[model samples]
Target: MVVIEQEPEEPTRPSSPAAEEQAAAAAGGEAVRPSSSAAPEEAAAAAASGEASRAAEEEEEAFEDALTDEQLREKARSQANDAKAEGNKLFGAGQYEEALSQYEMALQIAAELESSEDIRAACHSNRAVCFLKLGKHDETIKECTKALELNPTYLKALLRRAEAHEKLEHYDEAIADMKKAIEVDPSNQQATRSLFRLEPLAAEKREKMKEEMIAKLKDLGNSVLGRFGMSVDNFKAVKDPNTGSYSVQFQK
Candidate 1:
């Protein structure tokens, strides 16, 4: 997710003394300059407005004082890439926690710099990889989701999310992500292989879910029928495989 600071509300644009006096005259009150020491509310409002402007100026200056827009963008991208590179190094060294911190730093810098969408997406994907390594499957899914929001065609994010789904046994989601990955990169052998492998597994999960649903319906039916001194077991459907038909039968 893109990070942002909540800005202080803009106090009503400061009214000029002439405008304030005109409003006072219209309201049948004596026009008087609001003394800062005597009118606490007016003073507070003015103070708040000034503070808001100053804060905005400081924030703008912080970005503008150092570099031009193009230069700032370049700096942000470079800094983000550096952090990502360091994170990769830590990940390769099997320091998952440290890697995660570096990836997070990359994300923060990218946000502060307002880096490109690709940079944000890459940072998010790298963070997801760290989560995956740490066995935080759900967290990995969340990070991948953010990355995909930034760049839906991000192949690494797609695969990472798919793997996280697989870990959580969300077979339908895993298969869907893998299918999308394959669509994006038709020649991706790993995606193709995963799709082939997970298809049956997903199908099996679906079959199992169907059986559970059927069993639940049966139980509900039995409960209702029991109230009438009957049960679902009293009736049966005998399939005629040859004719692809079923014959209803009743137990005596």
Candidate 2:
């Protein structure tokens, strides 16, 4: 027999050494190691991604913290402006009541805002105009007074108050207010013209009453038959039929 001696049986490898190790590692829940050459880059990539995620989180937190109280106030002011715009639209359309409500709400909001005096003055003036249009003279006067208090030199408020006084037949008060307005702004032609127009009517009416009173006083003081002035018997009166005029003959 040729080379009858059998070579020693080759050593048998375990059927699945790597599979068993993976199963053991899986059971133990330990991370598997990557190949040594690629491991550093993979780890660096993971670290970079983790760092980026953390940075993004921190940025979001910082942005949230930056929303300040002034921003909130500005937001409120913007909303008030929106309300005022709506009111202006309605006022343009001649919807006085609706516009008044919008303006009032806007004014309330504006009052809470800082440095809103101008807007408040405008609101008060607008409300007064609406009230005047509605024939609410007292309310109009009240609003105008408030506007004047807010801004002492507000010409519109002064003019409107004078007009309200005029409407109430308080002529002297109206004249005084108009005078003050004109003093403040000499170029105000309306005030000047109003004074010119009203002053004459007032004077004329007073003069007419005074003339009537004087005539009554003369009649009461002098008797019709006073001897020095005249006697009915001594005075002769004649009526002319030829002319429409009556002729009176008197002896001196």
Q: Could you tell me how far off, in angstroms, the CA of residue 222 lies in candidate 2 after the best superposition?
A: 22
Judging by lDDT against the true structure, name the best candidate: 1
Which consecutive 10 residues in model 1 have the weakest lDDT in total?
Answer: 29-38
Q: Estimate the overall C-alpha local distance difference test score of candidate 2.
A: 0.79
Instruction: Report the lDDT of model 2 for residue 106.
Output: 85
Report the lDDT tens digits of candidate 1 across residue range 183-232: 99999999999888888998889778866976787799899989989887
- Candidate 2: tens digits of C-alpha lDDT, residues 170-214: 677678878989988999999999898768766776667766875
TM-score of each: 0.66, 0.55
- TM-score (C-alpha) between model 1 and the true structure: 0.66
Residue 5 shift from truth in candidate 1, angstroms: 51
Predicted structure 1: lDDT: 0.85
Q: How high is the lDDT of residue 92 in model 1?
A: 94
